[model samples]
Target: MGWLSAGDGYEVALVEGRVAARATAGRAAGRQLKSLPKAVREHPEVDRLRRLAEWLDRHAAACVTQVDTWMVSSLPVPTGLLARVWPDEAWQSALRDLVVVGEDPQEPGFLRDATDGGELRLVNLDGETVRLSPATVTLPHPVLLPDLEDLREFAAELGVTQRVEQIHRATWLRPEGLAEKATEVREFAGGSYDSRFALAARATALGYRVSGGYASCRVRDAGRGVEASVWIGEPYWDGDTETGALSWSDENGRTLRAVEVGPVAWSEGMRMAAALHAGRTVEEGRTA
Candidate 1:
């Protein structure tokens, strides 16, 4: 957004509310030394630049979290709000190319750009770009989007990577009679502090992708890959925090028999479950 200078001899440009690019302002700027002398390179100005970069990275991450929350909740966003934030590069990058549904809901389109006058330019399902002035628009869940497959293909052609989760996340309904199902790979009893986000965060830290309100990881053993998933519940941030389930399946999502699960797969699956369980809060007069 602006250029900030360190009193010594360095200046950095803040773009989109983040430190995007930097420039040296004095003699140091012109020096082409393969390596700067320790005295010059280790100056306070250099430290200032390092600190500024770190802060910028954190700010950018927070921006992403806020946008992700909006998409996950499927919140109805006002057209005016979109136009106002669209100018920020961070917001623009996250919003561009996401599938959005207007008031009609059924008629979905891919957002291509945000125009100057609170109008959204989108490519409709019929492969035509049209501008719409809806009162509110929603970034629908992938399951609710009728033309998801087509959108994925189009994205591939355009080499676009969506920052939003919808297109890439897989959705699944709990299988019929899952409670009466044959086998349980693992289960984590929820804790008081173990909100959906906390559990999902744990799963993500373990390199799993969160989808369909579940945190899942894939493991390969004996030449076959199996996915282990833990369901923390829908609207994971809300709802009862005392219950959760874990399951394992093949690539096609077929439930695997306990006997069919490899030793390593079983261990990893249990490890995830136990870790989550350990983080649970034990409340008095509560039973699982």
Candidate 2:
């Protein structure tokens, strides 16, 4: 909900409030960049951050302005650890005000935004809709870091203790060193790289055909055994936004089973694949 200025620091300003300054990513460039931190600049997972930062620099002024209290389209911070910074009072206040005047935009494949604007709105090229709800807060990109302390604090202040656990329900899938393989599976699985690839590789290695969402020997399953299917799409419901759920069918076109697998990272997904290859299921209905 704030903008990092072009100067030697970051400047964050809320609506109708004074702009505040503190050393920011700019400060990191000098001391931190004396040598790129392996975890950030050198790690394969962080290449996107490096690439995005380069793109943002090319369009500095335009990019910075995207940081409204409700919506920011550009990738300012890395989707990983950089997003885990302690939530300062400014951000908490802005988010608190945001929860009151708007409903969360939970539509899949549609960009949702919330800010100090009159109300919470979900807009697409078709039109826009607004609602008043205090039990709502727009879902931001998941904080990729493992630690959830800061996020817990924010949720507590918002009086949404459930959100603390909800954060664990989302997943991120970035396949390092397997970019080409990941790309192939993502396309086949309806952009579900994590679940599909993780499942497919393990199944194929164990002898099965790679189908739309599952690796099975038969396209249809009768009543003999459970014929399953997984749905891959962004999930949003009841103000909770996690990755999609996995669905199964009985070949009679009747729903058989479905289970949710909270958010999963690519690295974690791969581990699940390894488990499947080892003849172990990951304690979830979805593949990985």
Candidate 3:
């Protein structure tokens, strides 16, 4: 933000998301000060600038959260909608470099830009710039992408780093013909924590809901919604605890078997479970 009149000779502006001061008329004219002068720090203009910075921070976070939801769910987003928000730096950062599929699922490209007319520019795998104006596009989850390893290799060569995780995200595939009647996965269980609060805290920090002894996250996949849950321990339990089996349930609360879980759901469920497990307290002299 540009400097604004704060007082008789001082001007204030937001520098790198923080309020900074400068002398508009004096020996250090036009020079930014190392610290805010005592007088300028309490000025109304500085307070206003501080509030604006805070709002910008929240706006940026909200943009990232929205884009993350779209990618995680692999939901189809209208080209028009992306074009509307493309000019915004926060939205652009969260979207750029994400893989997008248009009318033809066979062709996927890294998102580069969105035009005023809703056309999208992309960098395809062959190092060619391409344009697409499909009515909608899907940011398929990593597990659903074909030749995922190849995409990772290509992205690395280009130094493409996404603000949100996608191509390089960890994923797991459900084993084929696993017990059709089984409703739980113990692969991430047996993780020990010092207390239930610690285990629950980790889940909460990971953006999973902690309620009634279960840490869970909901995802939409394969045209259906499902919730993946892992037992963390009862609320208010102060004793040491350990993670329990992971499981999936439909919107109607019907537990799904290992074979019944969809690909994205399975991957997301495992991701959540593993993240919670990774925070377990390790014993000394043993690898975490």
lDDT of 3: 0.92
After superposition of all CA atoms, the RMSD between model 1 and the true structure is 13.4
The model with the greatest TM-score is 3
**What does candidate 1's lDDT look like per residue over 1-288, in tens digits?**
344454454444434433333336555573333433444455565466567768867766676666654564466789888888888767887788788888787777778888779999998767789888888888865655677788788767766678766677544323343444455643454544446676666667755688967766666544467787776667535644543666789878899866666644565566566666666666779773
Model 2, runs deviating above 4 Å: 1-138, 141-149, 156-159, 163-166, 173-175, 179-288
Which residue pairs does candidate 1 place in steric collision? 1-14, 191-280, 191-281, 192-281
TM-score of 3: 0.97
Q: After superposition, how far is residue 85 of candidate 3 from its true place, in Å?
A: 0.5
Off by over 4 Å in 3: none
TM-score of each: 0.55, 0.21, 0.97
Clashing residue pair totals per candidate (backbone < 3 A): 4, 6, 0
Candidate 2 structure quality by residue, lDDT tens digits, 120-219: 3333223334443244333343333233444445445544422122333333354245333221222223222344345455556744445554443322
Q: Give one digit per residue, the lDDT tens place, for model 3 in 2-42.
A: 77999888999889889998998879999999999998888
Order of candidate numbers by lDDT, starting with the best: 3, 1, 2
Q: List the residue pairs that clash in candidate 2.
A: 70-114, 102-120, 169-263, 170-263, 171-263, 171-264
> In candidate 1, residue 130 scores what lDDT?
80
